[model samples]
Target: MATEKWVFMVTAQTPTNIAVIKYWGKRDEVRILPVNDSISVTLDPDHLCTVTTVAVSPAFDRDRMWLNGKEISLSGSRYQNCLREIRGRAGDVEDMEKGIKIRKKDWEKLNLHIASHNNFPTAAGLASSAAGFACLVFSLAKLMNVDEDPSHLSAIARQGSGSACRSLFGGFVKWTMGSKEDGSDSVAVQLADEKHWDDLVIIIAVVSSRQKETSSTSGMRESVETSLLLQHRAKEVVPKRILQMEEAIKNRDFASFTQLTCTDSNQFHAVCLDTSPPIFYMNDTSHRIISLVEKWNRSEGTPQVKF
Candidate 1:
């Protein structure tokens, strides 16, 4: 394997997801197990997604990655965890044309060169990490000939970013907060395929392109430490909301869908405000947009938008 000059590569693209029933807190930080069940809608991959190419070569000295054409560190525990997990599941590979044969055990010794690019702006309050991690895991899994399903691969992606698990599936997906301590059962399941709700239209308005002052990881950590509303939301409010949202999705009840979506988003913001020092994710412009949408809904006698 060391003498081979050929590089085995695979490229994959994954879409980002918007959580309708948000996952804000974690029960296990290291494993990235969320405190409550959350549901998300996977966006169109053609519109917002990450394209990652993973190449494994015997000549490469160490694992490396480039994000958006800039070299980035792979020393982070998240990246290392995903890499290790995927490597552990790798299967034997043979490329007859390239005259390359890689045994399952050989994956551990081989180094990887990964290059990822996002079509959308990263760190601008969008779910870029979700798409990025999902793309990384998906591409490496393909390159290594991992036999695991998307659900199994999603568990690895979850360690990178909790919301990343939901990005592995299309359409309406749910991440069930599994009760297992090992977090093996915590995986994303598809409720419906992308074509199920073709009538639905989603519009995203970006208010700012700057990186957030408080990342979701740090913000959620603060909420877990300080916000009582976060605790209650996880324990009491989200449970009922999850069931209702699931039902609304199953039945395609647009009215109930709009109601639940708006309420859950408001509650998420409320929890943020309830945090110590009150993390502000939405600015004045965001507030104005919400107000305008609410007024429009009132005038129309039905909900028009879910912000």
Candidate 2:
């Protein structure tokens, strides 16, 4: 066994993303595969993100984690799945200076200690999990010396959070919902880098920082089970909308992009309402804010701000 005194770790920061074409349901729940293709714009890491530190040591007996300085269980399938996938791809790591050497096969026997902190509120409908899980997978991959590309690592992150797949990229990203049962082909791809749409400004409205009563995972499951609209969306609406969104993004058509973004966001909430026992992710304040934006856009004949 290697010396228990030495600790080898890697730290990484990943940004949260906001979906333009929102992902509302899942076809494979255990894999966290989405029901439809969704596109998103990655946010600035300096503003909102998750910073994760993954440490490996011989002294540790088991995998453990802490979120926001609070110890959290790693027994959850999301965490376990990411760990398993990354470990499977683990490569031999050696550091002569630190006098540490880990063979590829040694990863399975080793334990990890992870500490993650998110700048934004978690589970408050701000897509914090997107950043949190992405950072978790990314930092661990670095520590394990996994040689996979970002797209490959994104597939692993998707198992942690569906939107997390998109966070692996810089600016515009699309998560393709693959038809395969194994979800091997389902992964996120970068559409455009941050410099592609440098003129665009993103502003997030803070309605409530409180935790949501219904988590996105549970709500998505409910919608998939009971909402016919969600099925229709997965089959019909999003496919065409995705193409349009792609064009709008490519052409830098601000008007078209804003239209698609606002439309998809509203329809996503509508799917929630269509579900049995209807989920209400937005509040009265949220509705009023949307209405105000619409009114202003109408008066100006162009979008000043898109919700």
Candidate 3:
């Protein structure tokens, strides 16, 4: 063991993702294999993201973490999964200036101190978990010298949060629901880089709600348990939509893109309604917003009109 006590760290930023084609249910919870393909837009990292700094030092006694300057538990399975995966792939590190050196074997015994900060408010209900977990995996990979590409690391991030896999790449992303039982192909891929469709302006309405009566996770599970429509959707509907959405993104077809996005979102919520105790994610306010958009579109008499 080299007698270097100096600390080494890596900082990285990862953006949140919003699924245009949504990831609703999982086939394998532990492996996080999706039942259907999902497409998402990697939001601007500057707007909503997590910035994480991961440091490894022999001085540390155990793995510790802090989020938004507040010390938090690292006992969560998500965090542990990411930490364990990255540590297993850790490589030797040498810093001539700081006179610090870390061997591949040393990483197994060393504890890491991780600190993360999110740009947006956690209360916003925007997928902060996606950004947080992506940032964690990304920063640790940098520190560990992981050789896998972003898509490979994305498979690891998927275990943290279903949506997080999309954030491993920039611009539009797609999480392919592969057929393999081992989930080797269940990874995110870039649909198009950010520059491909710069004209796209996404607006997020911070709707007021007194906590969703049914969370998307539980609601989807209920749908899978009871709804025949959901089964049909996973088996029949999504595969075609995934192909169309890919084409829309590739050709910058806003008309096809908007239609598919709106329809898919509605179908997902509709599946919730098919459950025994229906989930009402969209309130009167949500309905009113939809009506407003509908009326405006009808007045325009063109499907391709933009907001």
Over 13-112, each residue of candidate 2 has an lDDT whose tens digit, in order, gives 9999999999888888999888899999999999989999999998888998999999999998999899999999999999988889999999999899
Q: Give per-residue CA lDDT, model 1, range 1-307, as digits (tens).
A: 5375879899999999999999999988899999899999999999999999999898899999999999999999999999999999999999888889999999989999999999988988789999999999999899989998888988999999999999999999999999999999999999998998878888888899888888999999999999999998999899999999999999999989888988999999999999997889898899999999989988998777768
Best to worst by lDDT, what's the order? 2, 1, 3
Report lDDT (Cα) of residue 10, candidate 2: 92
Residue pairs whose backbone atoms clash in candidate 3: none
Q: Name model 1 segments beyond 4 Å from true.
A: none
Cα deviation of 167, candidate 3, in Å: 0.4
List RMSD in Å for every model shown.
0.9, 1.0, 2.0
For all predicted structures, in order, the TM-scores are 0.98, 0.98, 0.93
Candidate 2 structure, TM-score to reference: 0.98
**How large an RMSD does model 1 have?**
0.9
- Candidate lDDT (C-alpha), each: 0.92, 0.92, 0.85
Per-residue lDDT over 1-307 for candidate 3, one digit per residue giving the tens place of the 0 to 100 score: 4665768899999999888887888898778888899999988888878999999888899999999999999897878888888888888888888887788998999899999998776634578888988999999999988889999999889888878889999899999988899888999999799999998888777676255566656776787788888888999999999999999999999889999999998988888788868777677777888888888889888664332
Give the better candidate number (1 or 3) by TM-score.
1
The clash count for each model shown is 0, 0, 0
